[model samples]
Target: MSGRQLYFKCECLQKGGAFKFRGACNAVFSLNDEDASKGVVTHSSGNHAAALALAAKLRGIPSYIVIPKNAPTCKIENVKRYGGQIVWSEASVQSREEVANKVWQETGAIFIHPYNDGRILSGQGTISLEILEQVPHIDTLVVPISGGGLISGIALAAKSINPAIRIFAAEPKGANDAALSKAAGRIIRLPETDTIADGLRAFLGDFTWPVVRDLVEDIITVEDSEIIKATKLCFEILKVVVEPSGAIGLAAVLSDTFQKNPSWKECNHIGIVISGGNVDLAVLWDSLKKGK
Candidate 1:
């Protein structure tokens, strides 16, 4: 974990504009013929819904997505563009889940959970598999944690590949349940969420908690300003339009939060997972020039 080379994985370049595709595709593929034919339903702030919609489209199955009323308009449009039906709920993750469950009860649609299913984890694991293949010896990996699906999947795969690799989860201070949960040694729910990183606001699932608890090395929380700064940096330095949640790993690195630990800097290479790229260009441009 210390004095090892680190490399970064830019999964923002992943298909469907985010790393969610890997999990969505895997979950859909894991379904039996009857299940797939019956279609799938899930709730999401944005990225996961789009990924699942696209995945269902690819599989020739229908997808029903429950989205919050205040979800980014662009994401809602993407879901429709990808041939998914949208069920709108109050502007909250809890409302979205309730709506999704209602849809499931009525339609018998297989619930393709946004971040809580074992098959989703297996699919998300493929991201680590790809990263390992791309970089031979990654000593430390920093991944954004939202409900712990992506990080849990990545940790499981990365640890299996090299037990010595250190896996860290980067979270926004506004949605710091994972950080708190890790400290409490149990799943802890957020009383209220107010982060710009909409995709990272959900609480960790029961299935995901166990995987993350046993496998992840640590959770690092960053401020909203830092997330904005990192998002701008990615656009300016890396020429990528990364969402706030997606840029958190970069934020952890750029803000020197990780570097605070002497041992962390000792690692020559650090791998950060740029999880998504579904930002509204106009909004991102405004954010980029805000303090300039």
Candidate 2:
């Protein structure tokens, strides 16, 4: 770890405290004046909700956010602070979708999917653009996979700029849909997510499947404990406060997953995308103290 450097494209520090802002802003601004006047709606538990809310505010349009009732307090506050109109739903994925669709139908608000839109992908790809500009040469780009939006965008962008640069994904073992989907050659949805990384609970979307399947070099999964440990490591070593989901890429790196890879022999410089930083500090501390 002495001579080796792990450079990070810190989206955690971005507006609304996550990379979701880029996509949200793109989606919001993509609408024409006529359609934009009706505003937009989205189903999200945390970061995306806050992002879309803020984006709509900047565009001077309304934002309807469908959130799970059990979503984190901090994230809920962020959405409210951004002036998002809240629509409560059950924790089930179906409920979230149903509510968002209902709002869009009733209000004629444009439905801006969190990760399935083309414009969203283009906006998220800007992260790779910035990375390339900031760090010209790197062996690989490691991104955390949720619904595959971030990874798919980064893969497409990075591969276009540097075909030799490898793009890898870090996913949670408990919610291993991305890995399973990549292997089965299709998007796979888990019955339920079982990880502390709340932001990554969603399965891959239609738009991101092909991009991730074709461009990503590999997908590595880590346990919840590994993510928590990696989160602490980021704070201790890198002096960065990263949430569990945000630190999964580092978790994969610190684990044997990377070292065991065939590409490890040739890869020296690595670039990681720190996806978000909206974690609840009390929960993290309690979990760490209890060793769970």
TM-score of each: 0.94, 0.97
Evaluated at residue 160, the lDDT of candidate 2 is 93
Per-residue lDDT of 34-85 in model 1, one digit per residue for the tens?
Answer: 9888899999988899999999999999999988888877788889889999
Instruction: Estimate the overall C-alpha local distance difference test score of candidate 1.
Output: 0.85
Best of the candidates, lDDT: 2
TM-score of the candidate numbered 2?
0.97
lDDT of 1 at 264: 70
Q: In every candidate, how many clashes are there?
A: 4, 0
The residue pairs found clashing in candidate 1 are: 5-269, 6-269, 6-270, 7-271
lDDT of 2 by residue, 115-170 (tens): 98888888899999999998897878889999888888888888999999988899
Off by over 4 Å in 1: 1-6
